[model samples]
Target chain A: MADTTTGQSLGAERTTEIQDAYMAMTRTKRMYGGIMLIVFIALMVSGFMLADSRNAGGFWDGILNIFNFPGEVLKEAGEKITLLPALMVKFFPSLVETINIAAASTLIGGLLAIVLSLLSTRGLARFPRLIGVFRRLMDILRAIPEIVVALVLIFVLGGGPVPAMIAIALHTAGALGKLFSEINENASLKPLEGLESTGATWSQRMLLGVVPQVAPNWLSYALLRFEINIRASAILGFVGSGGIGYDLKNAFSWGQGRYDEVAAIFILLFLTIVFFDQLSSHYRNKLVGKA
Target chain B: MTATAETLPITDLKQSATALIGRKRLLAFATPVVIAAYFVYLFFAFDIPGLVDRARMDNAAILVADSYSYKTHVTHDNRGGGLGFAIEGENKGTYPEGMLPEFVTRTGEDAVDIALKAGESATIEGSTLRYTRPDYGTVTVAVEGRDIILDTPDGTVPDWISASGARVNITGAGGRAVVTRARTEVYRYSMGWELFWFTLDSPFYGKSFGELAGLAFSGERVVADKSNLAAMVHDFWNNAMWRHKDVIWAIFETVLMAFLGTMGAALIALPLAFLAARNFTRLMSVRFAVRRFFDFVRGVDGLIWTIILSRAFGPGPMTGALAILITDSGSFGKMFSEALENVDDKQIEGVTSTGAKPLQRYRFGVIPQVTPVFLSQILYYLESNTRSATVIGAITGGGIGLLLTQAIITQKDWEEVSYYIVLVILMVIAMDWFSGWLRGKLIGRSE
Candidate 1:
């Protein structure tokens, strides 16, 4: 008991020293952090002040004249800069359109991924060469960018979210393929063994064994890919694909005093994303048995 | 009687054989039916011909001829060839009236030329003045028989026209002029045509950054590109694309964004993972609720979150970032919580049974056992987060990927467009290497 008391005292003293050092370091960091915060706030305020509606309109007019073709929507984008009321109307619709593009791309991409992903799994020991071929093939597919896929498809289909959808689907397939294989290769062998012992065919054993084991993994990968697809869809719109991104680009190029609206949208977007992310996480946790 | 009973078995066996034959007939009929059904499934599901055609199309781009013309010039005794074309209509529904043509041909010496349209606003003076393309040769036109033969200053027949009715030749310059149809394709929109035979052509994606900034803030009604406008789809994923811009930005805000988004939640649900663990917090009720909660959160998916956010923010980088944040957080949390449940708890008991404070015991006892696992988990999330950051960036208004998106969609500049892809690949590679190094340092460290 005496020895134990002494040990506790020594530990306490060590803790005090560590605490002191930590506090000193924290104070130094706090000073720099405070300065950064102040500077950031100042910059934002100044930018907001410069972003006047009238100024934006004037800027828009200036930009439109340089566009050469007044009838073209993209050329007229400069004209749209700076009108607060009009900005609000156009901004909202474009945002809505962007969401639609993302959502649809994710679902369709996710479905295609499920089929391709199975090929990547190593559970099919009987088809080792096929597994290697598919795994490598998936890697090559995933290696291409969403934009590249979008651009190539655009050459074929012309324009629109269809290209974006293709990009998302290919990406989803590669990503989910890799993920599905990892899950399959790591699944519990006991269940698979039990099925095999019952004289079940290899396919039957796989269905009874690997399918249930990787079900949660499939759900997780699909959800994650959906999130990525959302972002990709929005981006494709910037290239004249006609989504909210098109509106945003026009707003930026017309660069009158509409910076505040951009900031406002940024804030709104952040809040909404945070909310949904929180919600999805809740389900992912349940699947991993970690909630 | 006993002998007769035994003999009765032979008669019964004959009846049984008849029954067996009836069953075989039914099975034979069913087998073909099943085979037919299987083939029908394969045909509809595979769609082999359609897929083959699609693949063929993907490999080659189509070129359409809009409008074309040619010109040739004749000098003293030589012939030269030249040509020109107009690939698109100027808002006149694929055909414009009384419009002048531009030349695609190169200039050569001899010059008597005819514009294919036949009627010219300006009259050509005979003999002295001649027409020629900058790159192609010139053409001489004489009424087929009226001025067909001519003597030059050298007293030789002038070879200023080609043998073919559709071609022209100039003899003095010693060259030929011919006009052929030029092919062009108008993608979904008719902004411009890539020069045929030029594979490097791609969409232009940039203007001045300042110009883009103006369009974003300006009140004027900003119009969108055709590709975007046509994508106004009524679907969940389409909706999410617009919404997730916010999430993308959020993901880029901090490296810790991935961890906190994922594992912080895991920390909060530590008790649940512990309960689910057979050797740890084994209370059935606690385990059940924790498991259920994980399912509920993870079930919905990150895209849904992105969609929801896009609606709220209207669309942009923030939505994409926010989507990343929420997604990473939820996933990391669940992953880490599972690791916790799976951790060794021998030391945990020593501290807990001794009545050490809960926080103290956790810090000193449970932490050591799971330190490697936790560190590895964090590192992996960070690596994955970096890739995710790009995805978020693409949708959001900011990030290098935005430049790439612009290139692919607008300018059609394929060569430089590949630069963006290289950058993304480099980024992912770097992240993988960095995480792997960190993994070694953290998880592979000596106890």
Candidate 2:
């Protein structure tokens, strides 16, 4: 009876020791987290201040006046509501051009990305030794912002949709290459091995074996990239490449009298983006859901 | 009856298999055809032929050459009777009276000798300029009254020389010389960016690295008020031509905008996400409204947001930050809600079983579970938003993008444009690496 009581006391002592050690650990973790949070908050606040001081307009003042421009645009747009449809129609060709740029670039970039991703993937690489080179090449391509390329091309090619298309294509290739390669990593290699045993060529193996496995996911990603490219094309236009954004810039720069046209373009852009966003998301969900 | 049923099932399986294969085959061929057709349509629609015609190959060549090489202009003003040496003909790069490029030497009050590349030489004396090339012989240009005269050895002007009544231009393999009524200017091309370290006004301008190092360590200060190193740093930072200080600040502002926008959005969306989550919110109407709000904001897109915000805020990083914040809040809200819905119910139930209040339960259960996922997503967006910020900055007139656009617009500053491009690329890559590293440290590389 005495020994049993001693054993119970020993159990209680070990449990207390364990509890104390756990509490100490938790306390240290909490303290470290607190320190990190404090540092982060400090950085954020100081960064905001520096940005504000450097900015042309103060944030507090700007916040109060945020709706002024929008209100004016809306009021003007409201007055000339009937012209909105005609203005949208007038800008429809430019919008189509923008969509075409996105589409053509996505197709071309998707093709390039497939080749690049296949070459970089570990199990599927034809020349495994050159995989790093291909990967770095993609990194450089990705690292270059599309506007940089578009602006330079604009200087060379003059204002046109081709430069925007080429710029967005290059960027899309790089971005999709990285993502597609990740997808390639998850793909099973059994098909490739089977093809290899059959004495199939590298291209043949890729087409017949690997592409079949990854095509749906690749298409889904390509669709998402298409949506992104549309936005990029529009932006490139605003910066002087050529699209609806160029038209928007023209109208916006004309100031107060043209707010109706601006509203029209805004609505068209918003609608197109939403339509594509919904379409791509729906398809993406279906593709991934099946997987 | 059993045999008939068995045969029917086998044949049905075979028919379905064949149909599937046929559909796949049709899709394979049709996809490429459609793509090719689309390309054909685009080729005509984008006016590829016109683009080829509109393309300025000369401009491309100039951009390529100017990005790496700089030209020094040696000018002799005929009317004013003044001579000046300038790099790229810019006032900021004007050479002091005593200092000139090694190949250029003053011969008389208004006369100068310029040594061009490949044994070509030019001399400006009085109102006459003479250029001698090994293969092209000698070309003399004289500015007289309002008319410029050109004389070649053969008395036959080659296509390389363009002469008019008021101006005579000689373009040779070595350099270019123009004699006009106002001034006689000779341009000599040299490799590499000049005045990148110090301008002519700085005392440290012509010193070699070794000499500069010695000056830095020497006790004798170059300037009376400051140390040599401090002066050097100050000159380099405030370099009028390159504006290194401004460039650095612009890069910082871009990153700051991105950080503020991304983190601010994540903070704003976290609570909103709980309300949007199906399990957390009971009111269907509330959930529908929130979801629709998220969609509406996201659909408006960053470009429109930037335009609208810049109109009110008037071109700055704050506007860019807010634009990103507003656009990304929608994304974060949707993504975070999805993440919240996927959270394990058992953990929340366990917290509640401990007699924890709603807030405490969330703190102990929900936050811990979602923190890693949320943090990774935020970091990813932070990196991406840095790039977006550069684009938005261009629209909003803030950050490195503003500098880049300004440089590109100048057209003559191709070297500066290239420099900015390099810096922007480096900044993006560095941000990418830093965010990836942080994400890895904070959360295991799940995404």
Residue-level error in angstroms, candidate 2, position A153? 0.7
Candidate 2 on B291-345: residue-level lDDT in tens?
Answer: 9989999999788999988977888888899899999999999999999999998
Over A1-291, each residue of candidate 1 has an lDDT whose tens digit, in order, gives: 999999999999999999999999989878876986687567544432332121213223433343332123333344554554565665676665556556555555555555455655665555666877877677656656566566656665555545665676777777677777777777888997888889888667766777777878777766666555555555566544556556555654555455545433433344444455655567777877873
* Model 1 Cα shift for residue B417 (angstroms): 1.3
DockQ (Cα-based) for each candidate = 0.06, 0.79
Q: Which stretches of candidate 2 lie over 4 Å from their true place?
A: A1-13, B1-4
Q: What does candidate 1's lDDT look like per residue over B302-404, in tens digits?
A: 4335434433443344444445655555455566566776766678878888888978887878777776776676677666665554544455333445555
* Number of the predicted model whose DockQ against the real structure is largest: 2
User: What iRMS does model 2 reach?
Assistant: 0.9
TM-score of 1: 0.43
Q: Is the docking of candidate 2 incorrect, acceptable, medium or high quality?
A: medium
